[model samples]
Target: MEETISIKDIFKTLKKRWKLIMLLTLIAALISGSISYFLLTPVYQSSTQILVNQKQSKNQLDSTQIQSNIDMINTYSVIIKSPAILEKVIDVLELSQSVDQLSQKITITSQENSQVFSLMVQDSNPLRAVEIANAVSGTFQKEIKDIMNVDNVSILAKAELKENPTPVKPNPLMNIAIAVVIGLMAGIGLAFLLEYMDNTIKDEKDIETILDLPLLGAIQKISKVHNKG
Candidate 1:
């Protein structure tokens, strides 16, 4: 016959192994917290904003023309992370790193249906990140006009040193919270699995039901010692 467990059985199993469940949950939370706190590197991000100033013509450009300009800007945004642009930034900052090394720290994104592009730089040093972001923006603005045949890329915002820059990854509290939830799920699953594997009768009712016979007696287990004189 097929076997199944009821909600009562689940509760009883949990009560039996509550201590082990709690310990595993706590251990998982601590391990996740420790890994997030010490094993992950903290990255600080700095971003600079530039607006596309397309010269409005007397004749209104079609939607296609406007979208083409936007598409062109997006293309330039990718090229901003290229070695050409980063090499300039490295030289201007006197950074002693290869172009590939420097490129890894930069990101370029833009707002949708808008003409503004944001250049974000991330590094262990917040100040260096800010400097790199601003420098790249300036360098790109100076050359983007010649490269893209457009004269309207202007800096709208400059990266500044944040008083309390926040790290971008490995959030410890959030990680621990996720770990605790996962641990609880694992504990509940393990509890049910062990309960499913146990076939011995745990109560008098189970014995009576299985054998279809009256339960003569059920004695509570006890431990005692008697001295013989």
Candidate 2:
């Protein structure tokens, strides 16, 4: 015979196992919050903007020149992360990290149809992130002339260490919220699984459903009450 479940059965199972579900959720939240707050290292980001513009003799800006500069941003992005620039930056900054390790922390982004691009760096220390960002931009600016025969790159804005910089990673509340959701889902799944696995008859409803038979008479327990004599 095929067996099926109803909404009522689902609610009944959840109601009976509410305590277990809550316990799982609470445990997950605590674990996630603890890891996020105490165990995970916080990463900080710093960014510096650089412009790819040459000093034009004529005051009027040429559209073709501007378009060419914008198109060069992609090539510049790769060159900034190359060993030619990163190795120089590492040597100048006295950093212990290799070119590949430093390159992993650096990122470049540019606006659409614009000559300006940003160099972003992330590190466990906010001051270090800022220092790396500025150093990378400076090294790239100095080396591009020799590498590409173009003296067009200039630092527009340098990354700075703030007095009260905030880390960009290890958001505790978000992690906890995600954990709570996962735990809730897990709890609900376990609840339904347990209900499915249990086959013991509990009451008249189970007897009638499983045996396909109507409940007959039942023996009632009689309690004796003694009156004051």
lDDT of each: 0.84, 0.92
- Cα error, candidate 1, residue 96 (Å): 4.2
RMSD of candidates 1 onward, in order: 3.6, 2.6
lDDT by residue for model 1 (1-229), tens: 1234566666778999888788879989999999999998888899998887667776676776567667777788777877768888888999998888888888888778877888889898899999999999999888887777777778999999979989887688999999999888887787778777878997898798789999888789898989899
TM-score of each: 0.82, 0.93
Which runs in model 1 stand beyond 4 Å of their true positions? 1-5, 56-68, 199-201, 206-214, 217-229
> Which number leads on lDDT?
2
Candidate 2 residue lDDT tens string, 34-72: 999999999999999999997799899999999999999
Error of 2 at 82 (Å): 0.6
| lDDT of predicted model 2 | 0.92
By TM-score, the best candidate is 2
Report the alpha-carbon TM-score of model 1 versus the true structure. 0.82
Pairs clashing in candidate 1?
Answer: none
